[model samples]
Target: MNADDAAADQLPLIDQEDRLMASLVPLAGCRLVEVGCGPARLLRQLLQQVDGLECAALEVDRVQLARNRSEPVCPGLHFIEASAAAMPLPDGWADGVLMLKSLHHVPLDELDTALDEVARVLRPGGWFYVSEPIYAGALNALIRLFNDEGVVRAAAQAALDRALARGRFTAVSEHRFAQAVAYPDFDSFEQRMMRPSFADHRLTPELIAAVRQRFEPHCGPQGARFVRPMHVRLLRRR
Candidate 1:
């Protein structure tokens, strides 16, 4: 990882203006949209740090959308429930778009359509920031025992590359970093990951035993600590 990559590894946890990628993102007084925004955690952080940020949080999961709607927030924030392949927003709707750790979650068949939607929603010269988890590392090894995402993740990267070649967007920058994933124990890992809001994971006995066997070696007095590799692509709307 380069200096910027190292700094961005702590992107979500702390408010490091320099490391938060404020320079690459749209400046103040711009509207932003986040596809698959989930709980709007990153949107909340960006709104607090960036000046005059109007964000549209989009999610395909109605459950997550409803949960976010119940929470109170400023009027500048809006929530929309929609799939990435078919966003409800109008053309040229936003100055910037974000898909953090969410693009790969889009259905594999619709990945290209989702990228097209991203390009459609962004105005000329607008920015799109996409961050995806690299399918490797100790944590991933444990998870692959039951739910493997190698194929989908590879397809997601291919879609991004194809977008660049299609001439709708220009790849301005790319960065790779690592984020720390700490679990108090195996139970915490299972609860948080296996039952994630988007997908259901069935952990058969054999799968459970495999995960336990692989995860046990990493367990320490405090817990298990693993670093997940991350790849980020910053594209400018052409």
Candidate 2:
């Protein structure tokens, strides 16, 4: 029950990459792996901002993986087609592992396996940084209309708690922050949110109208700006 756990609109809007870098002050020269990296946007930012770091971006989606590989490669950066539950990386290969808004997306039955895989790949005392979107706020409400994540998100947290309880990892830090997402219009929102390459929500005609009905009210002269509450947990592999 942290303060930012609530739908607090007043929370400072931050470039999450800045916060991530600040948290990962020791990241330079480290071997980092980002599991379930859809576009590796954050990884790209890190590769540019930090020096001497080797990063591997793992994605399970074929379409997104192909697109990532097709893109121009960054120095000290590579892409791997892999899943969080069963990473192809060798044991003790990573100095840090990241799961950004993707843990809850793992099959509920495989949540523990994914966490264990993270622990397996990470060296002793390596960092495990996980960021999950809180299941609250107007944006969550709109998204829930099509893809409700309440149960899976809770399960994700519970799995972490279980891992901590078992002494597989030690809690190093926790942070809560807000990131603002703006959609120029409903069309933009639909294109980005509803039609992602990962999961198929099966958007129907009636469903689209209903979603639009709820989303339109949030629009303004500047379009829709929604605060996405994010919870971050930094753990160390024991």
Candidate 3:
């Protein structure tokens, strides 16, 4: 698995992507939509895994969404530039929905709306898969040097819990795991995770230096390795 996956914390999210897709049996030709699909990478993976599955992706970052849309279409793949709280998809349009480590990125005030939107799109008995990065871990410690996600992460979970309380969907599964994010060197990590264009984490020169100082301690002969905690919630629309 690459360092870009958001679902991996204790278990390898990429390695188990196929397993997760296959677990949704009898869905060979089902329609699925992913909210907050960064670059639509998971969508591509699912398309490859589930033959004849119609897939759609929604991304708040227009840059990433544009790039993803420009990629050669894979028959049933579609990409849209929109936020989770305000997707353009029609109600009851999807058989399932996936959110991979992205709910926290939604604006705090709009989180519940986004969950409502997920329910709106999913047909009754459809599934909603949510994977989020937990707040405690070596990776979180290091990344907090530049961008701290504590508040948003907690907010995301609270939103998920509140959604569950409404009883519109029934919880089917809950999982937790950790995964290793390997960087050949500090440069790679800086480029990929530190100043990623998708987020608003702007690093100043001083902050960059601070991050370097914090990150250097973890670097070794094989480069830096970080263990990130992840959590997944599988729910079914009732």
Candidate 4:
């Protein structure tokens, strides 16, 4: 889906987190932390599911955090402004940690440190769950055609695999969720794709126009649709 459509049709806060939390049911009653929680959507929903289950979210961007302050805080929910590389919590404090759709922004060189931090904060037998996009098939070709520079989809998969191998966590489950988002029309699609956050590096007027042209033929009269594969994994500290 293009930016406006994405924003307008954004997943309902509770539904989105419920899907993620469903996979973590085994860890119910354990303290949970969410890293890189943008807009606090998932964090807000997570707080509703379990009573007295300590829930906290860490966001690196103060500006985003400030905007979230306008929203009422839920009971047992806490928001912290901090970097993922150096979580403020003491070691072995969290029984489960989550990072969803934010890993791509992390620099490749610092990935190890990020994983190290996740490993450090999690208690033995704790769970680390992550859900991220894994561009492949037609989507990979489309990204290459659009000259997207966010993350090499393949590299992201490889890095996560390597991190699991070297870090103290052991993989328990890996699943792929196919998400298809549709835009109302070309204009809507363009507006969404051109968001500063989505296309900060490689977005150009010419490239945007080209992408529109390339996907235009495929778009139904109503709008264009893009299918992207999302990767979800659950890991446990060994």
Candidate 5:
């Protein structure tokens, strides 16, 4: 077993950003790219805390991209509308590439090409941070009710392992942690999770009702809170 396979369930709950920042300290002042950045919430936080860090945030959703660009632009931060399979960035330009719970969303057929794009953009010894949601968890069970990701999620890991076996990257570390996810009610969950702009999760009336039936059980006055288990793999370019 490699160091990247270290057990994570035994570890206590902690903020994902805290774990990420600990490893990112060395990359301050270096170039970083976040694929499928979505709202770039974490990138905003990183820009605020890390000095001189240049960031390229890429997202495939044009609607979301417009919103991200409409927000105040931070120094050294650029937003691009792009996919992981074909990043427009130049070769060996980034010190680090991050995929925060986004790899599994890539088309299964393009997984290899996407990883190749990541490897292509990262300089030798550059880091690749992949944060994927673990298949087991209360939140995952609920999400799986409508949008089952078992196949894609498993494919994401398998692609990573293949890349490693091919000497594309050296395994560095693996971390598992549970993140706190809260939904003020079923509507909040439906709007955010079910109606995301990136993909069409076709929700018929029957499907919506079915999802609500399962989700309502977890709701209370303040709302439903579930711990989302996450698997983070850190690798270095070979």
Candidate 6:
């Protein structure tokens, strides 16, 4: 399916962002803030579930912010165009903070300051949750092929560890979740792989094509399948 068709069919629901929001439903009554909320997909869902709850999303990309603004926003959902390191909200203003599929994009040098901002915005006893990809062994190879391996991997884990040591949060939980992606044919698989998000990496188009060709036969009747493993960490402010 083309990108537009896939989007229309809600195929995007299979991504990590959707899963993270589903996981956070238990924290329904709390006021929530999401950093790096690309397109505010999860933010919209959260607004739908929690009645009278306030939710704010901080997105750095002006283009994305403009698109989100053009969409019909829920009364409880608010969007702010800003960096994660400097949110406009007051300190300790949120009952929960979420960073999903976004920590990896943060620069390593500025990560500490960003985490501090997250901590500052979260209320005492509030929850801070982050879900990101961890590069382990072969996974590092795959990620490096597409993007900055060392920086993305290290920054994600560093943010987690640093948040754990902040003393403001307790009972930190770290776990991994996996999602499956299935492609119906080589054409579809190729299209998905070549998306701007994945293509900018170091992996050459030829290499990706070769890998896809070699693996296509083993993909079961579903055409092609790959497991995307995600790391999730949850912490409650003390």
Using TM-score as the measure, the top candidate is 2
User: In model 5, where do residues sit more than 4 Å from their true spots?
Assistant: 1-11
Write one digit per residue (lDDT tens) for candidate 2, span 17-125: 5456556548778899999999999888888887888998999999999998888978888898888898998999999998899999999999989999999999999
Question: Model 1, range 147-209, lDDT digits (tens) per residue?
Answer: 899998999999999999998799999876677778999899888877777787876888777
lDDT tens per residue, model 6, 1-238: 3453233333223454555655654555678898988877777766766566788989887767788789975788888987878889998999988888788777777788888888899888788888775454232333344454566667678666767787656755766655555678766755555443312445577877666666566467767655555667888877
Candidate 3: tens digits of C-alpha lDDT, residues 118-159: 999999989998888887766887788888899999999899
Distance from true location, Cα of 163 in model 3, Å: 1.1
Question: Measured by TM-score, how close is model 3 to the native structure?
Answer: 0.89
- Give the Cα lDDT of each candidate: 0.82, 0.88, 0.81, 0.70, 0.87, 0.69
Per-candidate TM equals 0.88, 0.94, 0.89, 0.78, 0.93, 0.75
Give lDDT tens digits, candidate 4, residues 20-100.
Answer: 557555545768888888776776666676556787788887767787676876777788987778899999999889888
Among residues 3 or more apart in sequence or in different chains, the pairs in candidate 5 whose N, CA or C atoms overlap within 3 Å are none
Which lDDT value does model 4 have at 200?
51
Any runs in candidate 3 off by more than 4 Å, and if so which? 1-14, 24-26
Comparing 2 with 6 on TM-score, the higher-scoring candidate is 2
Of 2 and 5, the candidate ranking higher by TM-score: 2
How many clashes show up in model 6?
Answer: 2
Indicate the residue-level lDDT of 28 in model 2.
78
Off by over 4 Å in 2: 1-6
* Steric collisions counted per model: 0, 0, 7, 1, 0, 2
Please say which candidate is ahead in lDDT: 3 or 4: 3
Model 5 is weakest, by summed lDDT over 10 consecutive residues, at 1-10
TM-score of 1: 0.88
Candidate 2 residue-wise lDDT at 214: 96
Sort by TM-score, top down from the best: 2, 5, 3, 1, 4, 6
Off by over 4 Å in 4: 1-17, 137-152, 197-199
Error of 2 at 56 (Å): 1.0
Q: C-alpha displacement of 105 in model 6, angstroms?
A: 0.8
